[model samples]
Target: MSNNRQPDWDPRSPAVFDDQIAAYDRMRGRCPVARSDYLHWSVFRHADVLRVLEDHGTFSNVVSRHPSVPNGMDPPEHTAYRALIEPYFAPERVRAFQPVCRGVAADLVGQLPAGGGVELMGGFARDFALRIQCAFMGWPAELHEPLRQWTHRNQEATLSGDRAATAAVALEFDGFVRGLLDARRKAGNAAPDDVTTRLLRERIGDRPLRDEEIVSIVRNWTVGELGTIAASVGILAHYLAAHPDLQRRIREDPSLLPAAIDEILRIHAPLIANRRMTTRAVEIGGRRLEAGARISLIWASANRDEAVFGDPDEFRLDRDSAHNLLYGAGIHVCPGAELARLELRVVMEELLARTRAFALMPDKPPVRATYPAGGFTSLALWVERCS
Candidate 1:
């Protein structure tokens, strides 16, 4: 192992995001595990990423859990919160949201004309995600535009990694959630049940959750879902447009769409990496990470690890590698992962069913998001709008 420590891998590198198929391959060879001041120590290999996620005692998720939700908690306490929250995102709940998700996608698709094209990122991706999030959480429709604006600003601030900006966004998100919580409380049990209602009534340890904790949990789910789902949708759309045969296959047999979604998520995980702190000294990929140190587990790199995912560079929709770390692994695995899958499945299904073809504008540069998020910044597709 090299004695030199370098800044954790930078996603801003064009070579990594733009030329990803090649970038991760070379990095795994030269530096499977690199250290960065910004992301702390990063683990690129699949085994290492799995180890960190599974061993919560040694590698703490609590470091980032201040915004609450079980994501920031380790086992025991984490397990309890997950038990309360998981059922809300279970298969039945996800199934319930499918129609609503498809309606949202159909509405967006209807807005595009047969001969015209639109920037899929802002028009379709963001709007679809926002609508589904608000519907699932049962928030008022009036807050949609402001909530969308806040979501965008919050993502920008977090990716910029400015402490003040991140703090500001957090406060803004909390305030918005607090207002909603107050309204729900005033409505009392007479109001229909929704995620907010369940959260307010559920107990974590002894009594019902404190208002701040409720705000934190809701904030985590809302903010985290918005950007990631939007980016993932954009990525899948970009790929399907680039590869027509695969698109046709998915369209002909909707069964293939779900598998295709998993493969796409594995290939282009929306987030570049997530941070975790070490609670105790631990050896990962032969390097000893000391306690109090932060580590960035590069999910994109890990998903493409040659050792685990054969032909890691190619996009094979039928690969049996269902264990990809896209939603992550172990305890802090995404709480809304099933919901995300449902959203992707419904959107892809509707898009393919409605349209037979799409055209990517030539020579127009596709903007790439750096670090925190993945996928194209502005993916404008000349979609063949259906009747």
Candidate 2:
């Protein structure tokens, strides 16, 4: 594989880091299928991305050498693990957790400042995500701070592209999960009957899942839940604050929250992109890619493609949901979509129900999160609580 193609874009550039959504939008128009030094090949258009996703044989999910549970697997192997993981997010399971999720949301919303500016990301969004995830996994409150810090470190290591740093952070996370597993094992039958403990008992092919497998599965779930859920919260709140009319409509009609939440997330994606590797030479978006080429599905851009959606930023409740790739499509669609939906819907319901209105703080604007992260890193909003 001789390399002679000039880079189409620099994914690590300061401009991309400043506003990833806008940058991706530009890329989608300029070069739907792009090549870069860091990301290798990036897919931007909705149709092109859907093509890659549908044809998993050509564009494989086994992009990483490291194990990623089901996310990094393909075919029969992916199918088995997906079956094992799907039950955890079954409709019944997600419905059962609604109360717990609502309780966490209500508590966080109630803690918002009475009449002044509030940094939604720190003061409310992050805490809500942390609490709900810990509760779902039967983890102790003590793990909240550590997990939050771990998420930050993981993102930093990923952005730096320092393999050693990324590996070190991953090991730190594994250590945390391993300790929990050991404690649960020691407790025997007395162990809490939760997702984590249940995973320890899950069997694959007539034998119990190995410790490493369990860690990987749990790590995948934790990362998705913590990062996307938190980013989604901030994005939702910011959208509502910026669009007071839609906010008021949702506040008046709580039934619209679910659809509205999905639409808002589509406009500004939480999880930026997913990786894939081309198994064979293929042509996509008029660009020829050789075998073993790395692919990055830019969800942030694909969901907002003008070809699919007339105006990427337009807020429409009646739009078709199937076209939205917020949870993705095809074999590798998000397993926890129902759980994520329930979490987002519950939190927004509580917030809107509790407050008359919340508006963006003019003096303190939000700082958009860098690449590998979506939504605001810090969002300041002025709240007007219900009297």
Candidate 3:
């Protein structure tokens, strides 16, 4: 996997995840808009990422005619679906789920080794986030394990760059989500407050949304929420543990945890790239992009661009310009972003409030994902609780 990275960089090194500052620093000007047969033309500069996202007409989100629910659709259709689902992830709704998210975090963290030694990723990161998503979306708890397994499998298949496998997994996941939607409809009227109930009853494009569309939105969301949120917890814990002073400051004042989490996500976005298709001939970085060219907006690289963010490699919790492209830009930005933020904040508060410190084992290094999914694979930590 490391060898697949640009010849100049080595992400395979265990130390890189622990210390990505140097690698990202070296990548800025060298290959800002690199083209690869596997991932296509990856835009690393902040300006390029923003331009690709902002110019929907030139670089359409509807890439390869993929069935990505509304994510693949441009304005109008995209706008309609966004209207239907955006409210569900609004600030107030995120706030409403805080208690549930907090409870889930506290329960999981409490079950960890109080004195020390816990695999932060699998121990609590993956399971807890999956459970929380289940409760929030009115999905059954029994499906958590199955859903987690499916998320990992689908990610691997998609990253393999295999069209057949990606399609197979997509169909399987869509079926699972569709079953849930069907059950909701048969049971008649949502219990008044569930997201599925609302989605089932909503209308899009002059008519009610199809069951498959609802399934696609819910499936994409759950898969993303579970993996990214879980991986983020590991990243947050690792960074905090490595910097005791920052940990101490955050422990002393919980208010800083949210800002700290945002900074952490901005600095280490779990996602790698999102694809866009060029509509016509265009120029980028003095290169001509012909019509129908597939481009990848590399958020991981763009988030670290020095032009928009001074001293971009440094992880400053109080960075004045943290408008990182981690959550993407423009209209197609993640609708569940606020929900993700709230979940991270609550989890960080719980972990920090309970554990005094966490340390990576001297000899054992953390695991990381391959090209497409870029984040921690395993985060083993030694927990120290406050007396």
lDDT of 1 at 99: 85
C-alpha root-mean-square deviation, candidate 2: 1.7
**What ranges in model 3 sit over 4 Å off?**
1-25, 189-193
* Candidate 1 structure, TM-score to reference: 0.94
RMSD of each: 2.0, 1.7, 3.8
Candidate 1 lDDT tens digits, 177-280: 88888888888877658888878888877888989878878877887788888999899999888888877777778998877788887877787777788988
Q: Which stretches of model 1 miss by more than 4 angstroms? A: 2-22, 65-67
lDDT of 2 at 249: 87
Better candidate number, 1 or 3, judged by lDDT: 1
Model 3 residue pairs with clashes: 367-377
Model 2 per-residue lDDT tens digits across residues 255-290: 999899999999999989999999999988888888
Find the 10 residues in a row with the least total lDDT in model 1: 2-11
* lDDT of every model, 2 decimals: 0.80, 0.91, 0.77
Clash totals in order: 4, 0, 1
**TM-score of candidate 3 relative to the true fold:** 0.91
